[model samples]
Target: MNRQESEAHVLREATADDVHLMLSWRNQETNRHVSKTSHEITAEEHARWWSAVRDDPSRRVLMYVREDLPCGVVTFFDLRLESPRSGAWGFYLDAEGLDGRGETLPAWLGVMREAVEYAFDGLHLDRLDGEVLGHNTVVRQMNRRFRFVEGTPRQELSDGREITVIPISLARTDRRQR
Candidate 1:
């Protein structure tokens, strides 16, 4: 993959049309715990969320575009100025992987890389928090690759799934050495 093709795996800032797609992915069984909703959300509720994000400075809802197609999604949101330089983040890729043609489906590591960069550089955050199902060893390992440490174990109310909330941080003094 060249620069553009590779970078096509990520995009920041989601539009209105992207919200519907996001909700479907969130309601998927694989993404239930990692999502904000236990059930599917209506357009009205989604609009409220979109409006709040736009009105809030410490929030960003982004779409993960791969090969110029919307496949998965990632977000650097819930920014707290009281504890500036910190935010909550999450991502989801379709389990299906990709479609025919050059467009890839589901989610990929390239988007995760860009999402982390957005958390550190784009959002200028010192710490970003994420949660993974205890069963999701692959994602847990992936978090470690980004220096995310298992912070605290918490129960996911959505599906009664046990999860470990990890912190993938990048402080001012500590940039990149990995």
Candidate 2:
């Protein structure tokens, strides 16, 4: 992938038009496998979830764009926009779409970089946090590359099964030191 093209990415506020696409991505088998909620979400469920959080001040749902092509979704929740601003973030990419175009790796890396920038710079957040399944070592390594420190692992019941969750966090100061 061209360096310029890989870096040509942006994050934009998700709109009503993106609801379907977001739902499709979220429901992808690969995505659902590692998610906190592993079931295929019904249209009604997705609608309710979107409606509840779309305009909520404490949550942000953004569309990830690479070279003008919408390729993923980024979300920030549990946002505390006060003096010690902090939030938890999560994302998922259009794996099938990007893979067809041979842009999967670049898009994946770009989304993370842009999301981190958005969390700290665009949102003026003091800290950022995320949760990754223990078995998802690839993503955990990626998070560490971005200076996110991993916390203790905890077990949570999801879709009738217990899953190990590893909490990771990055502070504004730590990011700046990169």
Candidate 3:
């Protein structure tokens, strides 16, 4: 299923059973556009990563479910609890027939809103930030809509062409509106 099929999607905690399925989706070209992957991940690698991921209290990986079908993933890392309450995040959708431009963008916005709220409220983090590819207009638009201020132009993760690193931050004042 794709974005069209994810209208009634549910965001749930990821599990050991969903590793391979998540890998298949993450490998899609649309997803790989901004993802860091040179090759497919091995099952063994996934297991090891999942083990470490599950054991890390500062991280969270959630699965987006559509009509009981798993369709996407979103993960947050590098959580710090002291003066800065924030974490970094990344994700991609796997619903096969859905349009990234039409359906996935909106879905991602809602998920991102919730994720930010969780970071500030539940985790008591003061900020949340992330980097998006300069070529990925759809994602950039979403981040802008979510009040993620654009940062300086940087070649931080560019595959070849210079990619601007866009950062989104959420502060306590920002959360008060929600």
Candidate 4:
């Protein structure tokens, strides 16, 4: 993608209309394989989750817009709106859709860039944090490229199996240095 094309990608607050689309993306095999909770989420369960967080002040659900089309979702939760503003974030792309158009890689990189901008600029956060499965080296490397410091990995039981989870954080000072 060219500079203009990359700049064209942005994010908007997700609305009710995008719920099912987000669920579909989250349930994709590739997404599920890497997620802490890999079970397929039922529509009812998804609805419940949406209901709980839709109007929450501490959480933000954003839709990734590429050329005016929504192709992915980014979510910020565990938000602390006080002096030291911070939050945890996660995202999933419309892999099938973007892959068909040969835009998957660009979208992946673009979304991370936009999300970081949103956290530090739009949200005026002091820090942003996230977690990655230990086995997901690509994401770990990508997070590092964004200047996120990886914390020590910890083990967790999920889906009846033990998995290593790596925590990562980026302070505003570190991001500004980038």
Candidate 5:
């Protein structure tokens, strides 16, 4: 599909069947290298983790689907339903399905737009925070496009190597201005 057509993608709550696919995507080399923890996850670990968050009221795990195919996963955690209405979120797209097919940019843009809308409009969140590995310039730029302002940077270990992670946040008002 073309960029415009791909923009019609949807994000739905992830189901039990998605656990394997999501785990595979999360364990991909590129995804691991850019994540906070780079260790490969075993099926048992994934199952345990999935079971913990699957029914957590403070978390939302969603799958991005386009043309009836899964393209990515988006997750929101640490949801504070009280005053601030803030949360932390992260996402990753299927490289083989989207990027390898030369639809990376558009697919990412569409999924991210939907994710942001879901955060603000559906969840009524006042702000959404994200942390990106310093080396992931593409995602940092994408965050800018979505009006995510960069915050403080911190050091963390990924794959046994020290790496920087920069925090970014998007406020409801900021998104409205966009």
Candidate 6:
């Protein structure tokens, strides 16, 4: 594949129109399973969430655009612009794009690279934090590749199953060294 096709993901600020699409991706079986809360969300619930965050300065919900298609989403929440200059982040790809396709891994990597740059350089944040389910080894590895240092694991219940959530953090200096 050409370089552009191989690494063409872009992150755009999500708008109100993206609510349904974001919900669809979030509610996918695989996505839900790896999430802290595995239950499916209703339209009403999603609408409420969208409304709450759409105008919030402390949160940013972005969509990953690849070849003009929105293939994933990345979000930064709990932004502290004062003393800490940090935020928590999460991301998920479109389920349809990840069905044994050869593009999934590369697409994910490109999106993550862009997301981290946006977090540190574009947003000028001191640190970014992420929490992944312990069972989601792929994501855990990806975070490491991006220089996120793993922290103590926290136990959480998801769909009645007790799972471990691994916390990871990446500082601005970490990205600078990369």
| Lowest lDDT 10-residue stretch of candidate 1 | 97-106
Candidate 1 steric clashes: 3
TM-score for every candidate vs. truth? 0.75, 0.94, 0.78, 0.94, 0.92, 0.91
Q: 1 or 2: which has the higher TM-score?
A: 2
Scored against the true structure, residue 69 in model 2 reaches a CA lDDT of: 86
Off by over 4 Å in 6: 1-7, 176-178
* Model 5 stretches with alpha carbons more than 4 Å out: 1-7, 176-178
Give lDDT tens digits, candidate 6, residues 1-178.
4567645667899988888899999999988988988899999999999999889999999999887888899989999987668998899988766655666887788788878988887788899998988999988888888889999998977779899999999999887332
- Full candidate order by lDDT, most accurate first: 4, 2, 5, 6, 3, 1
Model number with the top lDDT: 4
For residues 1-178, write the lDDT of model 4, one tens digit per residue. 5678766898999999999999999999888888999899899999999999999999999999999999999999999989889999999999889999999988998899899989999888999999999999988888888899999999999988789999999999888332
Model 1, residue 98: C-alpha shift (Å): 3.3
Q: Give me candidate 4's TM-score against the actual structure.
A: 0.94
Write down the lDDT that model 4 would get: 0.91
Global lDDT of model 3: 0.69
For candidate 2, what is the TM-score? 0.94
- How close is each model in CA RMSD to the real structure? 3.6, 2.1, 4.6, 1.8, 2.5, 2.4
Error of 5 at 120 (Å): 0.1
lDDT of 1 by residue, 1-178 (tens): 5676667677768887787787776666666644535456677876787778766786777887766777777866678656566888777765443433433323556677778777777777777776666656777777776667676555554435344444445453454431
Report the error of model 4 at residue 24, Å. Answer: 0.5
Span of ten consecutive residues with least summed lDDT in model 2:
1-10
Clashes of 3: 8
Task: Count the clashes in each prediction.
Answer: 3, 0, 8, 0, 0, 0
Shift in Å, residue 57, candidate 2? 0.2
The global Cα lDDT (0 to 1) of model 5 is: 0.88
Candidate 1 residue runs with Cα over 4 Å from true position: 33-36, 81-84, 97-106, 159-178
lDDT of 2: 0.90
What are the runs in model 4 whose C-alpha is more than 4 Å off? 1-7, 176-178
- Model-by-model lDDT, in order? 0.66, 0.90, 0.69, 0.91, 0.88, 0.86
Residue pairs of candidate 5 with colliding backbone atoms: none
